[model samples]
Target: MTVLALGLNHGSAPLDLRGRFAVPLDALGERVQGLRQHLARAQPEVAILSTCNRTEVYVGLPALGASACPRHAMELAEPAIEWLAAQGGTAPAELRHHSYLRAGADAARHAFRVAAGLDSMVLGEPQILGQMKAAVREADSAGALGTTLHQMFQRSFAVAKEVRSRTEIGSHAVSLAAAAVRLAQQLFDDLPRRRVLFVGAGDMIDLVATHFAAQKPLQMTVANRSTERGRLLAERLGAAQLPLAELGQVLGQFDIVISCTASSLPLIGLGAVERALKARKRHPMLMLDLAVPRDIEPEVARLPDVYLYTVDDLAQQVQANGERRQAAVAHAEAIVSAGVKSFSQWLDQRASVPLILALQRQTETWRQAELAKARRALARGRDVDAVMDTLATALTRKLMHGALSELHGSAGEAHQQWADSLQRLFLRDTA
Candidate 1:
């Protein structure tokens, strides 16, 4: 079957729509298994790559015996899209408007570019590779990874390594954490005097904590859903820790609030921010929500003294300073192009595999038929030497009969077509 990738990402869909499809790390394995079982009979091999920015399903379809060629893969695109929509409980029509359907060589190139961070919101961001690896591992565990998908990801990882090592694509990389720190500087002249509160004990918070901590803010606090998790990160940064329940109680104590939680709803509403702004005597506060669904309400941005930046909002800031990395875009694109060509050649070999097997089987059938005749002749008291000669002659005729029949019995265009095919089949060795 051909390899295909179908999904929506931050570039293809909005943050709200992407969040609806985002699969948590803990839920990825089960979701993969569900899809595997769902398509087990018609399409057995599949893998899923789900992240904060994207959720894509990669599948291998039987392309030899059935309507499963590269073009057939395009037809199967709707089914794959339907499958993803089923998983996320979304309308297929809605997702279709903002999704990518790439098959065969195109799919390989997409995977390589994504793993290399070329397709990320933040160019050359390294987090996507890890997310991809995790998705593949889950698919493998679910017994859904087959030769096609397995090879695609392995080659993708290799391409990513080559791009990262050979080019300076990441030289101007701007992470969300770094972007938040830079933005905070705009509001507060002296970072050392500003108080920063990071809500959530996850990777985003840890990253934000590290960068802001480097500024040695006057006070830094990590409030997480779990106090224990928050305490560990806070200790590393020499900051205080608090439970997530206290986020509102102490909201006024910090000048800058950055949050990224796994919650499905807003953590801080407009009312809470309004109260915090009033407590500080209308003092302006900068808040960044790195979460997908958003850890803070959108209405907070309307407040006079509160600045609310969502993930997409921060992405703009990251891209604004990404011009330095533009010089290496051509170099990286060249590497990706070479990588896609190599992958396409490999896919070509795979496509010819069925024909090679059919030819070998056909030859074996002819050999067996001749050998059986020779054995029967020897059993009937024929001369062994003569029987051997008869066998060899019969074998050669049997092998060439089908080709000769098609070549001679045909006329006009058909005759020339068969002759050309036979010429290649029999004369390639001599040439």
Candidate 2:
């Protein structure tokens, strides 16, 4: 089956639109299975990669017939867009404007580039590789990952590793965590004196906490609905856990706060931050909301002593380092190009599988016939050497007989083509 990749990303859509397309970790498998059902005729095998920067759907479909060679997998594309729109609870027309579709080698090439972090919001950021692996694992669990997708992802991962080891693609990288810390430094002269409170205990929160912890903040607390999960991350970071309910009450105690939670609504509002600022006697506070829906109210940024930054704000801070990583792009791209070529060659071999099997069966039949004749001759007391020689010559003649018959009947251009092919098959290097 040919491969197809379709969906929108940070480059093609805004964050608010992309957020609607985010698939929760718990629902990834079910979503993949649903997608497969949506395009069953196309032999849909699906894997979804959703992150802060993008949400892409990868599909595998049966190849077009010989008469339709070079045709796009547009049959799968329309139904897929409808299914994806429904899954995201968005209007099909709305998403289609920002969506994209890539077929055949282009789909595979896109995947390789993505896995190598060439398509990330932050150039060469490594986190997307882990996210992609998670998506692949989810799709496999749903029985939606078939041969084509399995091979594509496996090759994508290998290409990512090759690029990493062979070049400085990830060297001097700038991350969201680093961006948050850098912004915090701009407001506070000394991080050691600031009290920091981090909301949620997911990967993004963990990453941000690690960076902020490196500065050795005076007091750091992790707040979450589940104290058990919060404590696990807390103990590892040499920090303490706080009940999420206590966040509002203790907001005044922290000089800096960074939050990333999967809540449907804002965790901290303008009124709450205002109260905190009043409690602290107008002392400035640097706050960040890294979650998609946002953990802090947008109006909180309007407060005089409150510095609230969203994921978008942190992203802006990291773009300045893009030029440093651009030089290695060519090297990483060369590795990706070679990887695509290798994958294409492998795909071509897969297409030859049926023909190769038929050839093997034909040869076996001819072999069995020659063996029976040889056995009867020996049983009749004929010379063994003569029987063996006859068997060898007979088998060779039978094997070449089909090609010779076809060649003898061919004429003009067809005759010339068959003769050349026969010469190459039989004479090889001499041809």
Candidate 3:
């Protein structure tokens, strides 16, 4: 089977399209299971990696003839794309412009580069690697990871580590969490006096909390579906914890709210925010929705006193440190290129497994035949010891026959020179 990757990411698609393809964290396993079942009918292995920034499908399909490869790849990718679009309430054409399909070495290289954060909107963002790992884990739990995807992801992780160690890609890169904090600071001059409410206890929320906590806000609160999880994070930050149920009532109490939850639907609607705004007497509230599917409804942006920012809204702020990191891009690209070549070589070696196995089988067959013939000769008792010696010599000569012929047949300058040396050592003695 060949390696293939089909995905949509922040670079190619806007938040709306990306949101359509976002899979909730809780439902990821089930969604992957369904995808695997569908692909299993046509192909053997399939894995999915869905995050706030990207959603990718990696598959292993039989190597069809040249004329059929494209057709087969498109066929496999079509259903997946349709399924994703359906989830996002979009038409296939709506996503086509933003979708990318990569195969073979390109697919492998892209996966590696993505995990290394070279492909992110914000270069060297570390969150993507963890998100990719989480996707792989979900795919594995869904029984979707097979030899091809497993190797691809493993090499991806290795390349990411190599890039991180060898390059300054992440040196001055501003994290999304930090960028969010920076954006919030621009909206509010004094972060220390502003009340901050973080909704969700996931990694993104934790990161945002960490960055916000550094400012030592007037009041900090964590609201999550799981009250215990919220409390855990809140206690760590010396903040307060509130259940999701209490969010609406207490929403107005905070000046800033940073939310990133795995909800498939919008958790905070325009009406809710408007109500909160009215309660605050139209006081400006800075809201950053880091969730892919968006915890806050887009309409909330229209509210006068509500400043809502989606993942895309933060893109401009994230580019602030881009010029500083430009010098390191070349070094990072070099690292990625070298890593890609190594991964491609490994993939090529993997392709030769069947050929190597076939050669071994042929050698084993020849050995068994020679051994059986020797057994018969010894049974005849003409001379058992002589026959055993003959058998040993015959096997040795048979093994060398192909190598000796190739050495004599060599014509190329480099090949002929090596062949001449081998011939002098082995054939010269025989002659």
- Candidate with best TM-score: 1
Estimated TM-score per prediction?
A: 0.92, 0.84, 0.85
lDDT of 2: 0.85
What's the lDDT for all of these models? Answer: 0.84, 0.85, 0.82
> How many backbone collisions does model 3 have?
1
Model 3 compared with the native: what TM-score? Answer: 0.85
Q: Across residues 84-114, which tens digit of lDDT does each residue of candidate 3 receive?
A: 6666677888767788987777777788889
> Which candidate achieves the best lDDT against the true structure?
2
Count clashes in each candidate, considering only residues at least 3 apart in sequence or on different chains: 2, 0, 1
Which residue pairs of candidate 1 clash? 1-61, 1-63
RMSD of 1: 2.5
Which pairs clash (backbone N, Cα, C closer than 3 Å) in model 3?
Answer: 20-88
